[model samples]
Target chain A: MALLGILLFLMIIGAVIAVETRNLLSSIVCLGAIGFLLSIVFLFLGAPDLAITQLVVEILCLVILIRATIHRRVETVAGNREFVGLAVTVVMLAIVLMLAISMMAGFPSLGTSVLDRMAQAPSHFYLLQGKAQTGVTNIVTAILLDFRAYDTLGEATVLFCAVMGALAVLRRSARRRPEEGDAGDEGEGGAE
Target chain B: MSGGTHQGGMSLIVRTVTRWLKAFILLFGIYVVLYGHVSPGGGFAGGVVIACAYILLTLAEGRERTARLLSERLAAVLAVAGLLFFLGVGLAGMVGGRAFLDNFLVGDSGAEPALASGGIIELCEIAIGIIVSMSLFLAFAVLSRFRVSLGDGDETATGEGGAS
Candidate 1:
């Protein structure tokens, strides 16, 4: 609880820094710090997986923001237009915080005992006897790999596609290089 | 214009500190990916670390080398590998009869939460991390490159480009 309080304090500080900073890069860095601290709070709350996911996503967001900032002056504010964006962002953040706090208040504590119960469930039994299973000691590992492997596979595929898609959108098509492809084709291709 | 071929006349301290920072970023990335299960880290965290490290490297050492090292083909390969690893694990479960990815027939449930049991998740996490890191790096490289290209003839553009 003390940690949460500290984290929340830090979160507010981060928010203020991110908002008040004229340097876009500094703001983005502060935003990333906010996310990192929030994920630590989540870890303290017994949600390591969530923390990991949040950390990963936050990094991705930071990279994207940094990329966007590279095209313009980091400290150049777009007059009052940015204020509108800041307003929208604050409003959205507030709504989300409200929803989250309400949800947290309503939830009951199940604790680590759920893991033991889940370990003994019928699905758990089915997971243990598998032949191709990797002899990992973590049941979460087995469930993730041997039992829920399909989901993991799907998730990996999705990430791969997302990465590819981002690369495609952000970079020149590798195949379009004249040196790599037919050099003669470019002159004709330009007419099309 | 401090564009006199000397790297903005940055002091030795700044240069050395930046280099150390890049190394630290890369090391942290490796740690996050490798020790994901035991700690509050995982493939995703590691991958992002790798991406940051790459970006820092690019910032310190020019883009061409970084681009060459992180080629499009390598990114594609990492993505495919992640997908294949995930599918291969699930297919093993399907072969044993309790639907796709079922581990009971494969003797997984009887397993303890030792390194071996956690290895699979770790593997998947690593795969995911690679895909993510490469993609983000690619995005950063492209965006910066585009802006540099656009700033070619305009003073204001160059000012804005260098300002960030």
Candidate 2:
């Protein structure tokens, strides 16, 4: 519990730094830190799979953000008008914190009742019958690959489509010839 | 100028570490994808790991080297092949009078957890892993290339008459 509290405190600090930092790289690094902390929190909550996915996704996000920000200049913040934005941010943060605290305070008892009802739910059915029905030891894998195969297929298709779209968009410049010699040389240099 | 100058990627230390660690990361990813049915990781997670390995390689080495290793064309082909393989596995279940993606290989369920235990699940995992890894690598490659083109355009706009 103390460890979790420390993690939450660090997460809050990271979130604040990510939002308030003027340097894009620092903001991205703070975001990655928050993601790492969140993954640890997930592991503490007994979701090792989620933690692994979260960590990898966080790394990928950091890579993508860094690539995007590589050639861009550092962001500059306006001083006087930024005060209004800060005030608004503080107000929003206070409201969210109050709501989150209330939710956390109310969650455990509410979760117990929900879990009690869910004990007799389909989760129990999967826990008991998943192995026999799917011939897989891991219930999650059985559910994803056997019981819920169609959903997974749909997700795969969506991923494929998204990739296709990205490829199409990015390959446009490659398809078009460079209009000038200087641009062509620069393109070759960049490609190398 | 000195030939020792590394113009593209990071310093020597990072490049050396990345070179040594790349193979291990790729091996771990394959292990995760293969053992997904019995382990915590699945196809998507393993695929992401594999893609990250390549992305790291691209970051450490130059783009030309990475592209020569796994070109965009190869990545595209692999992505398509993975999707076909996944669909083929699903369609194959229809042959044995089962539903799509049905686990037809009802072998001895009481046997030890081996490679061939999960019927079509393992096959699907491999297929998904290939699709995801290749597609992600392709996306990264293309996006970086596009950013280069954008940068080139900026340079051209700035140096239009001056270069002439």
Candidate 3:
């Protein structure tokens, strides 16, 4: 309960700071902090893997956002458009929070014991028969790699595609011709 | 010195520290990749660490040097290797007369919990980790190089044309 209270306090403070800050970079960093803190709370709630995945994805998103924003003009004051954006963001956040609260109120916890029992049942029989061969201690890994390996394969393929797509977009404006590069080099040499 | 205005100048001590930190990051990344199953460290974590290290190295040593160190060929090869390793692990199970990625058919699943206990699932984790980290590092390296080049061009246009 205390942990939840702390998280709530930090989140509120973070939200306020993110909205109130005039410096664009500071606001972005604050948003990243809020994300990191939220993920830490997730970890404390027995969701370490989700916490790690969220933390990584959030940090990457933050970096990409900051990098893009760095190249753009930062308005010191919140304009009308900015106001609208903030309002929309707040509305979305509120709706999501309400949904989460309501859903969690009715949600039954899927304890590890059930998963353990599953691992020890058909899976156990397979093991005893020398037919179950997955060696991951973490049941999540076992499920991910063995029982639902097809889904994991699909997700991995998607991630690989995304990486390739990003690389393609980025490589478009890369150094293309040696001549152009050489021209730039010669120009630099002449200037020096 | 293909020095760009945007690339901030650092003192000797700062450069030294950055270089040392870069080495530590590289070593840490390798550790995470290799011991992913046994520890909290895994492929995604290791890959991000390596990406951070490459970014740091780029900041310290400049774009051209960073590019040379992380050649496109090396990144591509690593990415391919990671993918192939993961696929190979899965394929091994199919060869054992079971469905695709059926590790139990290969005598790797449902073992004891000792160091030599667990079976093929452990290998799959390690493979997944490798693929994830390698792809991430490759993506970051390629993307950042593109950014640095554009940044270099902007610097040159703004009258900072001298090479360092």
Separate DockQ for every predicted complex: 0.26, 0.34, 0.32
Winning model by DockQ: 2
Alpha-carbon error at A29 in model 2, in Å? 0.4
Report the alpha-carbon TM-score of model 3 versus the true structure. 0.70
Q: What lDDT score goes with residue A21 in model 1?
A: 84
Q: Report clash pairs, candidate 2.
A: none
TM-score of each: 0.63, 0.81, 0.70
TM-score of chain B of 1: 0.67
Model 2, position B113: C-alpha lDDT score: 67
Model 3 misplacement above 4 A? A50-65, A75-101, A109-133, A176-192, B1-11, B104-118, B145-164
Best by TM-score: 2
By TM-score, highest first, what's the ranking? Answer: 2, 3, 1
TM-score of chain B of each: 0.67, 0.83, 0.66
Error of 1 at A149 (Å): 3.3
Q: Write the per-residue lDDT of candidate 2 for residues A139-183, one digit (tens) a residue.
A: 778788887888888888888889999888656544444453334
Q: Write one digit per residue (lDDT tens) for candidate 2, span B46-105.
A: 999999999988777756667778877898999999999989988988886879887777
Error of 2 at A176 (Å): 5.4
| Candidate 1 structure quality by residue, lDDT tens digits, B24-89 | 778888877766645556666677778877776565545444556766467567656766765665
